[model samples]
Target: MSDFRSQLQEKLGLSSVDYHSNLSKEALFQEALTYDKGRIREGGPDDEHKAYQTRLGVQGPLVFYTDPSCTGRPVKDTFAAAWPEFEDKIWWKPDFQKYDPEAYLGLRKRVVEHLNAKNARLYVQEVYCGVDPEYAIPVRFVGEYASHALFTHNMFPKDVEGVRDEDEKRWTILNVPSFHCEPERDGSKSERAVILDFKDKVVLICGRADYCGVNKKSMFTVFNYLLPEQQELSMHCSANVGKQNDCAILFGLSGTGKTTLSADPNRRLIGDDEHAWTKDGVFNLEDGCYAKLIDLNKEAEPVIAAALSMPGTLIENVPALPGKPLEETDPQDLDLTDRSITENTRFSYPLSANPNVMPGARGPHPQTIVLLTADAFGVLPPVSILTRREVMYHFVSGFTSKLAGTEVGITEPVAAFSACFGAPFMAHFPSVYAKLLAEKMEAHHTRCILLNTGWSGGPYGTGKRISIKHTRALLDAALRGDFDEGNVEYEKHPIFGLLMPKSCEGVPSEILNPRNTWEDKDAYDRQALKLKEMFHENFAKKGFGAFGIEDVMA
Candidate 1:
């Protein structure tokens, strides 16, 4: 205990009395069991007894609450007596628990060090829940040397404090609310999350969720904790605001060239994952970029390669041989099944990677809002400028592919319309972000454009994927305002929503429609109907039946 106290005091930069008086070491471990029990109850208390009996029959109730506040509870008493079940659930596998405690403590120390360096206040709290309807956990702590309580919650204390009220602070916070549920064998749980940002005395809640199914609950919670606040001018998908005058907002889902396209050397990067566009200008949500580090080819993404080689960048799940050179290893040959290494790679870079970017990673109101889509079906044109109404329509449409290996069967091209391109992460509802975006764009006089970076000549399996280089060229031309200068005529198609001509010079026109691209018109029609039907089914599952393909099919 003395050693622990010394360590805590040293890491927190607090006197021994300060450390002991507020959230002592004894409290942290003593609170752990109660916290675990609360998690079990909140996760699925109804199944608690049944699961307990199935795993360990007649061994009292299968759940328990160690918090003194939860005394006299039937479920808690029963589970407390059935200590074996609690032990079984709480114990991490030996291998899983084999991580170096020193390393873990080092991480905590590093976080404290960073916060202290910034002169930020710190608050620590412990939360515990019971398996009941009235499960309310109260977390309390003192704001040592805090100038103002910047953020607060019942379950956690102030996240960032001790900063001046008028310091031009830019930070984001996310809150995931507790929903009704109980414990599981795998130790997974659900919660509702929201992202908030506080800047210039205004609060913006970016995403919210209401009963969006159990699979997405954890994702929402994680999303909230990742950002500073829900209102902190952040969007769910990848976004990069150019630093130059007349800069535009680049938006795209996971794989649609959002990071690759936006990390242009000529344009400054505000952020790669999330950002907020206000009347004043655009504000970056993060200090780094969470880039997808899959199949990374230096020739394709040189800046990203350089970023990976730099410091302050955290690489998750990438295979690197100890004492071996990084150049000799081919990222593509790494194991694809390891998500930590293959799929979920993040790259953090300073906002000043590009010189033309706005200083302090801020930008004026977007001159253009470019929505990127990876149309696996090679039929859509490379680019199409849209009116405000059209932008709103497409914003709600939110079309994109499911990426390779995400779904079985139909691994080929398919149409998926998720509202705001982030239906799953939204906290309040589907139209919340879309409506806000429409309002913001209108107020800022921003135009909307859609760019397709997928197959252009045929269906997914048969057609050659569009050349990334050509897509880059087209994007560069658009950013330079070249297309707006040219008097190009758009041809409406029967199945696709819009089509731009090949005579536009930089873009190939043959991909204007699927029917024209495919050799067999019958096959094209069949594929089109199949995709349309799939869209209809997906929308139906979400209780949205108003959207119909025939209405847009020219």
Candidate 2:
């Protein structure tokens, strides 16, 4: 054990500790079920149990339940300690609260004291974040709960073959959810705080939020900060490989169809979220997929549906049927629509959950790069082919709507533009990643497509969400060169300037033009221009003048 480990052990006052360097799936499941951290719905005996035992049946599948109170990340309560070294590097947004070093140390002492008072045994799990040996980061997860450790096991890559035990670059996350902090003294906005110390490479997650995502993403924020130094472009995207080894990456913010679209049964899934495009190829930063489960239709999303029943998966904040005990609850009995717990209801399952997964979670150079946006304003075309410059423009713009109920107070879709599709996780300026993407796309001759999986015809209330079937059809067309087949005509979108295919084979020709489907052409024009203006304003604020970023003004 290092000095850091010794300090933690002494602070926690543990008589003995269970250090799982890398616990096996079965072992993790056993621990999760044993300590009351999570309840495993077992099979056999009764009808409910019987239903749980079966594979992907109507009753869904058995799941391990986590605490309802912490279904989603506490974004508001999180903070990043402003040490001298990386203070200037941070984006300093509302989400990234600045914590004074003195205050952070004071809070850490209090949190440690509280943990020592609990006298509880802690589970220390060792894991790796990246799949590529050269860029992979070793991580240590220390938590009071076993289920979180299980989550750590399921969500991160475990093959740390070349990483040495003495690797000093490992990030140590201390998750003590029971330790509440004083807002005034801790320099925290709330009682719960997730603080990242860049200089120390340590994360302190204390108080009310126990969502496992906090731990995982804390390291991701670090990666988003560090990877760029190595000239690697880290992205908030999903990736996959086709039969011909042709790779594709889907970039989108939360509530967009990045997860849904990338899980095509025909293609081998490389990863569901968080990836890096290096000189070699695309590599998944995470070993697992964290997917939203609201209104999940097994038939429509067979790949994601299949993962629900996988043994090692961890379901967060999904409610069970009224009278069903967690131990006997069938996944089908659980209400996917229930937001009583949270709309951010999610599950984390390993890449192995998808049968058709790329081994080593890596793929060749991307042949297609997709920008997925749920345009709630419903003015953008369903699909449009983009020039290389257009791709970079949209890439930096990262326009997507904030879906209803995804956040604590948001009850309806709201237009949002997160730079590079994931502003929160990004640690550097958007230009850094944009420049890298542009270089790689040009070098690989990759085709880029803008996919709108949001509303069509009108704005949110008046319009309807584009059918997944249609979106998939459009994606298939782009991937298979169907868009380029025969005599293809392009019409420029008046406001956004994207070239829409005049007609696609499977898609209805009339709807190809968004204006045609709108009941009021004038209203469509107004909404379209409004959204375009929002895009211009966002790009202007980014100040990418040096990168030649321009607004698509008519």
> Quick one: best lDDT, which candidate?
2
Q: Quote the lDDT for 27 in model 2.
A: 63
Residue lDDT tens for model 2, 470-552: 89989988888766536488898877788899877788987777888899999999988888888777777777666576454
Off by over 4 Å in 2: 1-21, 33-69, 116-119, 164-166, 402-413, 461-464, 482-487, 541-548
In order, candidate lDDTs are 0.42, 0.76
* Candidate 1 global CA lDDT score: 0.42
TM-score of each: 0.57, 0.87
Residue-level error in angstroms, candidate 1, position 96:
27
CA displacement after TM-score superposition, residue 116 of candidate 2 (Å): 4.4
* Residue 254 C-alpha lDDT in model 1: 60
RMSD in Å for candidate 1, one decimal?
A: 15.9
Ten contiguous residues minimizing lDDT sum, candidate 1:
73-82
Off by over 4 Å in 1: 1-233, 237-244, 320-342, 349-357, 403-411, 414-417, 480-486, 499-502, 544-554
